[model samples]
Each structure stands twice: as structure tokens, then as C-alpha cells.
Target: MPSEVVVEKQKLKNPPLDLRYLGDRALRQPAKRVAKVDQELRLLAKEMLQTMYTADGIGLAAPQVAVQKQVIVIDCEPDNPANPPLILVNPVIKQLSSQLCVMQEGCLSIPGVYLDVVRPQVAEISYKDENGRPRTLKANELLARCIQHEIDHLNGVLFVDRVENKIALNAELSKHGFSAKAVKPIA
Candidate 1:
């Protein structure tokens, strides 16, 4: 079963969470595993979804809001009201596909800097739902990408760090007024 916690899929003028930007120290620290899932955590998850929607983002991580918990909210199809957003707590990557794909990726933290990143086409993940029920998800395509991207936030990685093309990465970051030095390449 999917997450039962639901929020209005609409943008709020004053979102509850204040998103931390790309170079923020909060975004650089690895998130702590959720010690316990409770009403307080669920409320934070709701605010996370609200902030993600308000920023027109498909995915969001707790660290993006300076929350040190292992939580993420994802709604790949925000336009579809029937689709409920996913709320993941203490998420862990169980597996990743060997097949890689390159797609244009953007981040709410990075704002206007959209760059190409190479990531696995499929991912198997395990997480706790808003109800604290353990769940497994095998996601592919956009959902897979979104999951991996948000999970990276848990590990203190930005999509820019996974970008292979240094030239393009530098240009994109510079154009967006972000220093290239802030990018710590994965490999």
C-alpha cells in the first residue's frame, strides 16, 4: 500500500518548509536515519510535500529543508490529482540497474541549473511509509530517477556532482550564480 498521508496538491503562498539552496551547509550534511516515525514526522512530511509543490518540484528531501531526518516526498505527476504523493522515511537503496540513462535533471535547491546526469534506469528501494510500515518499491523511468535523486540528498549529493560534463556543469552553475567549486564530483 502507498502512503496514506495526503495533502492538497496545490501550491501554497507561504509553504511551511524553507528550502535550503545548493550551497547551504544543511544540504551538504548527510541526513540522519529517522529514529522513530510519529505524528510529528508525518506533519513534517506534509509540509515537505507542500513545499515541493509550491516550488514546482517533482521530488524533495528532508535535508533540503534543513531537517536531518531520512525522509523524502515525491510526486512525479503533480498535475494528476488522483496520484497521491509518495512519502518515504528512512529510505535505503536495495539495488540499482546496471543500465544507465542520461537525462536532463534539475533541482529546486539548484533552481535554474538543469544539467545532464547519468543514473541507473531502475532502482529497488526499501522504506517506511508515513504509517511506519515497511515497504519495498521497484521504480523505473522518471520515478526511478526521482527516487535516486532524492535519496542522493540523504547522502549529501547534488545532481551537479553526478554530472559528467564538467564544461556544461560549470557553465550551468555559473549562469545560475553558483560557484563550480561547490560541486564535488562523485567520480
Candidate 2:
């Protein structure tokens, strides 16, 4: 059996998983590391990838789907069918670059809102593949940022929390009909 399953680029008859929004309690809770990579877990990853593609998102965390598991699916190039998505289980950040870059980031949970968030330029992460095989990846630029953002979701952290410019943050949130209070800023 293949270690990973690539969800075909086809819309399912049913709607995607209901994503937990910023103010939702489920989004605040930290996700638990997956204990076993069974058939069920693999199925969840497949479904997550499908949900992400359907929502036009590059990355998604298990908590976003109210799963409470440390699973994340990322696909930087969704338009290219040849490029497969990644399924990370029990991911751990091993190294981070000292350099920081600021980029506009958006989340499916907080739709219609975008904010500039600063993050490390590079990251090395160790994780398990969909087959539960150990794997490590060194990511840079957009991929690094995406992985960090999704990892934050596993830790109950939102990209809004990393937004330093409160004025811009509040404006975007307000414009998107989201409450500014929903953001829990980090020091």
C-alpha cells in the first residue's frame, strides 16, 4: 500500500468539513498528538486534503476541522495535479532560522481577512507520514510559513495572534465582520 493517498481533484457531493472559526472554542484548544496511524487516521488525512482543496487553502490543521488531532495537510501547488500534497502527523519543529520575514497570511477559518504576519524564513520539521513512517523536511519561504502557521493551529495559536500591527489587524477583522476581540495577541 502507498504511504499516502492523494485525494483526487474532484468536488465531493457533500460539503467540506465545517471549519472552526477564530472565536470558536474548538480552535482555542490544543490538539493532541496522534497515537496511532491507523486506517481511520489515514482516512481523516485524505478527507482533510479534499476539504483544503475545496476551500482553496494551501494548509489545514486537524483542529481546524474539530478533530483535535495533530494532523496537517499542505499543498503549495494545488493547481498542478502532478504535485502531491503532504500529510504530516505528530509534527515537531526541530530547527528554525534566525531570519524573519513578513508576509500577508490568510486562513480558511477566518475568511475574507488577511494580515501581515512575521515568521521564520526557514524551518526543519520531523513528522510522520500518512503511513506512520518517520520523515523530516526542510522548508523555506512560503512553505516554511505555511507549515509554521498550521503547526500553530496544533498549539492553539492563530495567525492573528502573530500580527504585530494592531491597527491593521483590527481593520481587517472588522472589515471581514470578525470581532477584534477574537484575536489573542502574542508578546
Candidate 3:
């Protein structure tokens, strides 16, 4: 089982956050790195976790909530209350495996749009924990993919932008009433 937060789904309260959707200008803006991880940042992480749970998402980034800050909250095992969640501030991917895996990825911002995106099979990241302590995490499988996805948000990147299938990507975006031109594909 991947790392997760021990959150009671029933007791979770949805935070009042306006989630930026696909084609939203705010979603395209890069998130600024958080220099200080204080109580307020911790509180934001809690709220982000709550919002992610409410939206049935595994991971979320500050930019998704319209806050241009480099903060991310992720829980790979949301169904398990005993599992702990991860909160990363100013997360930087220090290493990525050469091996790649294609996984169907979805985003809270681009709801209802899922596409297969190729990403590194493993990732090692260094970041500040919720308590402002330096921490490092090495993850594989779904957890690894989720981390990469959220980190992309911090850099103003989206999963759709990583999709290689142009026809499928455009079709999916169009089906969801989103403009394909908004996607800034990574070469």
C-alpha cells in the first residue's frame, strides 16, 4: 500500500475553494514556491486534502484551488482510513527513472477527461513537510505518477499536456467543451 493520511472520510469537511477548471487562466499560471511552511500552509494542506476527498481525487495542488503556491496534498489510499496522506511544500523532483509507464491520468481541474500519459516509473522528490521539516520521498506505481502530476501543476503543466495521442487528446478535450489549443504540450 502507498503512503496515505489517516483521515476519516465521514468527518471530512469540504473547504471553501473555487477549483480552477480546464482552460482557466489561473490553472495555466505557474505556482510560486512557498518559502515558509507555517500554520497557515499546514491548514491549507488540510483543506486541500479535504477538498480532494470530496472530489474523489487522489492528489491536488495549490494552483488547482486558484492559489499560486507550491503545495501539494496526496492520498493514494483514500478508502483506507488508517493510511496516512502526504503534504509537500516546494516539492522538487530530484530524480526520475529512465523507465517509463503509460497510465490513464485524470485531474480535478480537468474533470471527466482522462487520457493515457507516459511518465517516469519512479520518482524521488525533496520537499518540506507540513511541519516545515525537510523530507524526501521515493515512490513508484500510482503514488509516483500522482506525485509527478501534482508537481506538474506547480509548474503550470497538466496531464493533458503530456498526452501523446494528439487525436485522442483533442477529441477528449473537445468532448468536455475545452479548447485543445489551451494545452501547451511538452516536447
Candidates in order have lDDT scores of 0.93, 0.92, 0.88
Q: Please give the TM-score that candidate 3 achieves against the real structure.
A: 0.93
Error (Å) of candidate 3 at residue 9 is 2.7
The candidate with the higher lDDT, 1 or 2, is 1
**Which pairs clash in model 2?**
none
Please state every model's RMSD to the true fold in angstroms. Answer: 1.1, 1.2, 2.9
Please list all clashing residue pairs in model 1, or write none if there are none. Answer: none
Candidate 2 per-residue C-alpha lDDT over 33-145 given as tens digits, one digit per residue, 9 for 90 to 100: 89999999988998898888888899999999999999999999988888888999999999999999999999999998888999999999999999999999999999999
Clashes of each: 0, 0, 6
The TM-score measured for candidate 2 stands at 0.96
Model 1 shows how many backbone clashes? 0
* Model 1: CA > 4 A from native: 1-4
lDDT tens digits, residue span 108-154, model 3 = 99889999999999999999888878889999999999999999999
Best by lDDT: 1
- Model 1's TM-score against the true structure: 0.97
- Output the worst ten-in-a-row residue range by lDDT, candidate 1: 1-10
> Candidate 1 or 2, higher TM-score?
1
Q: Identify the candidate with maximal TM-score.
A: 1
TM-score of each: 0.97, 0.96, 0.93
Candidate 1 per-residue lDDT, tens place, 54-161, comes to 999999999999998899999999999998899999999999999999999999999999988889999999999999999999999999999999999999999999
